[model samples]
Target chain A: MLIELQGIVKDYRLGLEIVHALNGIDIRIDQNEYVAIMGPSGSGKSTLMNLIGCLDTPTEGTYFLNGSNVSHMDDDQLAEIRNREIGFVFQNFNLLPRASALHNVELPLIYNGTPASQRRDLAEEALIKVGLKDRMGHRPNELSGGQRQRVAVARALVNKPSIILADEPTGNLDTRTGDEIMDLFEDLHDGGNTIILVTHEEYIAEHSDRIIRLRDGRVERDESN
Target chain B: MQFRESVFIALDVIRNHKMRSFLTLLGVIIGVMSIIGMQSLIEGFQKNIRHQMEQLGASVFQVQKFPVQFGQQDREKYRNRKDLTWDHARVIEQYCTAVAQVGPEAWQWGIMAKYRDRRTGPANHLAGGVPAFFPNNGYFIEAGRALSDTDIQHNRQVAVIGQDILEKLFPYENPIGEHIIVDGRRYQVIGTLEKSGSAFGESQDNRIVIPLSTFLKFYGQNRSLNITVLAASPELMDTAIEQVIGVLRAVRKVPPGEPNDFEIFSSESLIETFDNMTRAVRIGAIVIVSFALLVAGIGIMNIMLVSIRERKREIGIRMAIGARRRDILFQFLVEAVFLSEIGGILGILAGVGIGQLVALVSPVPASIPVFTIVLGFVFCSLVGLVFGVYPAAKASGLDPIESLRYE
Candidate 1:
């Protein structure tokens, strides 16, 4: 098992009321497994994704990532975990607008204190893996929706992290570009990379090796595809 | 993140907002400029005073009936005292064991000199002293000899003209052995002095030297005399001064346990007085300039806050990619420091230019040492750091999830 979540719970305060963003939940994901978390709006999927990404600590739960307890880690310790272990791809692409594609891919390596000489080679290889070798010098604004997402994907892979966590990776693209991105993720999964995705589309869930559905801040169903 | 990456990010932001960066840097620029400019002028003034004092001989002191002053009340206080005279100088030289030599000088300012068909205006100084006056006061003969002991003993009407007098009275010919009319009386010019440049815009070589006897005859015996005494060595200066005071008290018949009426001044005292006067002005200038820098620092803080707010989403993205809190802080701090340093460098250049301009047009001398430039840079950068901390901390303390969601 690469990730294990036990009895996770998250709470929020809204003025005079306490809201439960995530109710009790348990999950286990094995190495190289492709999983998609499905939910509608206000179904706690975002909160769960935030927890899995090590971005937020659970109020009452224990999270074991690669056999290390991470739910109680501090901000800097979590940042180190994020740098060395997790790669995130956002729905909006989250590419630095002014940076060239190559520089964007090199961001994760820079944060990890990689030497400048080696960072170039690793970033270039990641770009080439995502079919962005020729367009590495272009800025995000100059690239199309799919190309920008590919650049973001390359940035995520440059660190060779344990798992790739992409939140609504195809939310901003048309159907054609969306299918292309899903095909790219399929290719990455076939290459033996662990991938966890969050989405609301049933068709997207069908492509994953396993599916977990959330409703009212609790898991409604979990099944292998 | 690495320091180099932080610098690169800072440079990128500055390049993106050219006008904003310039506006933020203006205060630092003006503050540093004034500091360097004022320092240069003050240094120049002190140097000029030190040079004049050096010319007057480092180990010498002056004794007169009254202190150097301009107030009417001071003049009235010294009016009843007996004038310092050549006889008093003689008494000190004879009795003071620590004294090396004593030279008595009597001065008449604004005297005119005429040679042949040419004449100078009433801007000349007519001084009467013995042979030791030339060497003791750092004046050297450029042409002929100086006043001799025989000239003073016999009261000869011979003079050694300064370079200004020589140039004005005998521009095309040698002044030695010529007869010059000074204040309607003819005196034989025995020599011409080498040129000694001006200080504080006052020409040093605009005078003629004549014998004490001849000066007494021409300018009257009622004039007070100032005695210049050189010590045997610098270490014996205090002893020499005390011995001269003792001899003067006995010769003038002053009663025991009474205060001496004469005032003795040395180059050290004069320099101390100059420093005291300039110190107050220096403090005032620094206080005023610091307020300007304060305003500049505030301006930098304001802009940095705006920059942080504007780039909230960017900060979130960086944090999501593994940028720690200190990394964010370091990046913003570097940006602010870079802005201030740029302003400081420009200020140094402008300050040196302004200092040189003032020197050219006025009496103040200007010198820009390397220390002032370094000080300007260091001070402004400190200002940047101090003011930058608050904004950088604010940026670094933001919640990563919130910042990423900022519109």
Candidate 2:
């Protein structure tokens, strides 16, 4: 198993109330599986994604990535795990505004202590793979929306992470650009990379082999697409 | 994250916000400018004084009726004291065994010198001294013979002119054997003294030296005399001073337990006095500059905090991509240090320029103190570190999840 979540519970304090964002969620994902998590607003899908991404630790239960329990790890250790094991693509394309595409792609490797020489070659290869070789020198603002998303994708893939976790990757894109990103994800899945995507669109979910639906912070349905 | 990366980012940010960075660096610039500029000027002033003292000779001391006064004093106390005369100089020379030589000198300022048609300005200094006075006061004869004892015995109207007088009165001709008129009196020029540069914007080489007897005859017999006493060697200076003081006290009938009516001053004592007087000035300048630096430090902190706030999303993205809290902290710390160091470097340049500018317009020479340059760099770095901590900590301690959500 590549990922295992056992009875994960997450809580939030909204003023005077204790809101249960995640209520006893259990799931298992194997290597190279393309999975989509789907929910409407207030369904705790984002919270669960955050926990899986190691951006937040679970309040209860355990998370095992590659058979190592990571739920109790400290912040820096979790950051290392995020750097080495998972790559994230956000809906809004959270790229550094002032950095060139190549430099943005090299950020993760920089944090991982990669040498400058090798980091550049790897970033360049990743940009080329994402069909943005010509756009490597362009800053985020200089690129089109589609090209920016492609740079973000190149950043996610440059680390050669075990799982690419994308949150609403096409939320800000036009329909045609959105289709292009979904097609790119299909190519990544075909290349034997494990991919986890969170979205509310059913059509986007259809691109994954399996879909897990959440409602009221609980798993409502789980089935192969 | 690598230190180099953080510095590069900082440079990029500063370049993008040129006006803002300059404004932020203003206080540090002013602070360091004042510190370096003031220190250089003060150092130059001290150097000039020390050089003048060296010209006064190392083993020599002076006896005067009045002390060198800085500010206001009770004039009545000095007024009642009897003037030191050539008789006291003779007694010290004869009775003080430790004294090698005693040269009594008196001065009349604003005396004009006329040679043929060429004449010096009325700001000339006319000094009268014995033959020993020339060597004792570091005024070695550059050309011709110094005043001989025969000149003093006969009260001859012969003068040894300084380089300024020579150049002004006899620019193209040799001043030796020439006659010059001073205050309607004609005196033959015997020799010229070597050039001793000016001190404190007043020319040292604008004087005419005549025999003490001749000066007494023309100026007045009642005028006080300043006696310069040189010890046989530097090691005998203290003993020679004591012997001369004893001789003066005995000859002048000063009571044993009362303070001497005259003052004794040496090069070392003058230097010490100059240091003490300027110590307060140095402290005042430092205090004022420190306040400016403090304000500059505060400005850095303020701008850093604002930068953190503005870059919250960037921080979150970095954290999400695997930057540890320490990496974030290091990044911001380096940024702050970079800002201050740039300000420090610019300040040093400006300060040195200001010091040189003053030197160009005046007699004080600009001497760049290497210690102050190093000190400026260290101080600016410290200010950045001290003031940078709070903002950097805040930046590193930011919750990645929350930060990522920040618009």
Candidate 3:
């Protein structure tokens, strides 16, 4: 298993009331798998995504990422894991608006402590992989929505992590551009990369090999496509 | 993250927000400017004073009837004390083993000198002292000759003229063997002195040297005298002074309990007095400068805090990409330091410029010591670090999830 979560619980305090954001969830994901997690507004899907991305620790339970028990790791350890093992693509693109496409892709490598020349080479290769070879010098604001997302995808892929976790990967795109982004994800999955996408849209989940539906912070259904 | 990357990032951000960064730097600029400017002026005064004192000779001290007066507070006490005389000088020279030589000079200022068609005004200084006075003090005879012991013994009417007097009375003619009149007395000029520069805008070279007997003949015999004593070596200056005091006390027959009725002063003592007077002013200026730096540091902190708040999303993105808390903190700290250092450089240039301007227009000398410039950079960097810590920690401690979600 590439990712395994057992008996996870996350609680948030709203005024004096305790709200369960994630309650006793169990999940297992194998390598090279493409999975979609779908839920309504308060279904804890985003919280699950945060956990899988190592952005947050489970309040209670154990998370085994590639057989490493990371649920109770400190912030620096979690940051190391996030850098080396997990890549994140966000709904808003989350690209530094002032940086060029190549530089944006080079961001993870810079934090990875790669030397400057090698960082440039790897970033260029990643950009080329995302079909942005000619647009490497263009800033995010200068690119279209699809091009911006492609740059984000290149940035996420540059580190060669164990898994890619994307939240609302095409929420801001038009349907045609959204489908194009989905097509790119399909190509990434075909290239033997593990991908976990979080979305509320049914059509987006339908393109995945597996879908897990959640309601009110608990799993409602789990099925293969 | 690497240091180079952090600096590049800082430069990029500063360039993006040029106006804001400049405004943030203004306080540091003014603070460092005042520090450098004040230091230059103080250092200049100290240098000039040291030069003047060096010209007066380092291993020599003076014995007078009264202490070196500043604004004349103890007028009655000094006036009532018995005047120091040639007898005391002779006693110091003979009895004080620590003293190398003693030279006594009686002052007769405002003496006009005339040489046929040329003349000098009453502002010329006229001093009556022995030949030992030239060597004991730092005066070196440039041309003809100094007053010999026989000149004083025989009461000869020969004079040694300073460079200013030579220039005034002779102009183009050779002053040696020229006869000059002082208060209707004819005196032959025997030598001309090398030029000595001014101190505190008073010319040092405008003077004439005549025999003590001749001065007494023309100016009178009952006036007070100043005795200059030279120590055998610099290390024995205090010993020499003590020996002179002992001899004078014995010679004057003062009681054991009462203070000696004479004063011993030196160029070093004069320098000390000047330092004491200016110490309070220097401390006050330092306090004011520190307050300005404090305000400047606070301004940097404020701007850094605002910058952190505005860049929460960027911080989040960096954190997600493997940047640890230390990395974020270091980046912000470097940015703050870079800002302050830029201000420091600008302040140093402006301070030096202003110091030079003051030197050009005013009497106080100004010097820009290299150490002060280095100290300015060090101080400004410290300000950045001290004030930068809080904001950097705040940025570093932000929760990655919350920061990512922050608008």
Candidate 4:
């Protein structure tokens, strides 16, 4: 298993009340897995996604990434892990609006301390992988919505991390563009990448190899397609 | 990589919001300008004063009975030393080899002179000195002739009138051949001096110069001898001074290694003393310039923090993409340093210009200290780097997710 979370629990303190955001979540994901975590609004799905991506630490239990106990990591270690092992894709197509597509893809290598020559080369390669070779110089504002998401995907894939964690990656895209983004995810899964996505749409989850549905701070179903 | 990217990023950020960036750096500009401009003006005054003092005479030194400057006790203790007499000056002339000339002069206070019942009632000044007085003090005789050594030996009652006296006392007559009543004695006017306008504020052309012997009978051996010595050249100054000191020490018989009992004042020494005394003012100026720099640093920090707040989401996106905390920090810091350096450069130019203006309008000459300008640049750059650190660190420390979600 590339990712394993056992008995994970998370709680938030809302002033005087302790609100349980995630409870007894147990899951395993292997390399080449295409998984979507789906739930209605207010379910613990986004909270679980946050934990899986190392954006937050679990309140209880252990999360092992490639056999490393991620739950034990400190803030700096978590950030390091996020940079080296986990790639994140966000709903708003969170590409830096001012940066060129190629430059946007070069960000991970920048944090990775890659020298300039290699950064340019690898960022270009990543842009090519996302079929944005001709749009490398165009900024996000100059690109189409689908082209912007492609740049975001290029950014996620540039570091060659062990897992890609995306939350609502197509929430702002049209059906045609959404299908194209799903196809890219499918392509990345076939290329032996561990892909975890969070969404609320049944059709989006149906395209995944596995779907984990959450309801009211609890995992309601864990099914493999 | 960090440096290059940060520079490019900073430049982009600054360019993207030109107005905001200039406004943010305005405090730094004003602060730097004040320090540079005012310092230049002060430096100009000091320079002009130094030059004016230097021109008094290269080799000349002044001698007075009570030291021109001395401790209260020293003045009192030496107060009774028999006034320097003509014989002592003659002894110095016979002994010191390095001295080129020693002209002793005397001052007559509050006296009245009369010319043919048109009472020129005491001129305010009637000075008595030997002929060597002209060259020793860089003065030249403009009329008939200066008082000769023979005139002093015979005590002949002849006088050299300054131009102002010529205008006032002998406007209707040829003053050189005329006789004037000076201190209850009739004296022939031997010469008239050229108008020597005072380089400083006082008038130089108003005095009457007569021979020491002529002055002695009327004023006599009661007064101290005031002498000026001329050295052959600037190189011979120290040798001449040492020779004079040795002659004085032998005459006074000052004990072997004991400090000289008599005082000597040279133009160089005077210049040195004046410069040394202004040390406190220089220190105060430095402290003030540093304080302005500090305030400028604080201003950079404040403005940078505001910029970070305004760009929180942008920072978060950069971080998420792979920007290390330090990368973000460096980017902001580079921007700050750039802003301040621009201001510092402008300030230095303004400062030099201000100094020039002061020199042009005031009596003082503008002297720009090269060291101060160089130091100002280094200090300004350092201030930018230091003050930008905290804000840069704060930006670097932001959590990516939280920053991204910030509205």
Candidate of highest lDDT: 2
lDDT of 1 by residue, B134-246 (tens): 86677899988999999999999999988888878887887788899988888999998989988877888998999989999878999789999998888889999999999
In order, candidate lDDTs are 0.90, 0.93, 0.89, 0.80
Q: DockQ: which candidate is best?
A: 2
Q: What is the CAPRI rating of model 1's predicted complex?
A: medium
DockQ of each model vs. true complex: 0.68, 0.81, 0.69, 0.30
Question: Taking candidate 4, what TM-score does its chain B reach relative to the real chain B?
Answer: 0.72
Report the number of backbone clashes for model 4: 4
lDDT of 2 by residue, A85-112 (tens): 8899999999999999999999999999
How many clashes show up in model 3?
Answer: 0
Model 1 segments more than 4 A misplaced: B65-82, B109-124, B149-158, B179-187, B212-223, B233-235, B251-260, B356-364
The better-scoring model by DockQ among 1 and 3 is 3
TM-score of each: 0.91, 0.96, 0.88, 0.74
DockQ of 4: 0.30
Residue B196 displacement (Å), model 2: 1.8
Of candidate 2 chain B, the 10-residue stretch with the lowest lDDT total is B68-77
**Candidate 3's chain A scores what TM-score?**
0.98
TM-score of chain B of each: 0.88, 0.95, 0.82, 0.72
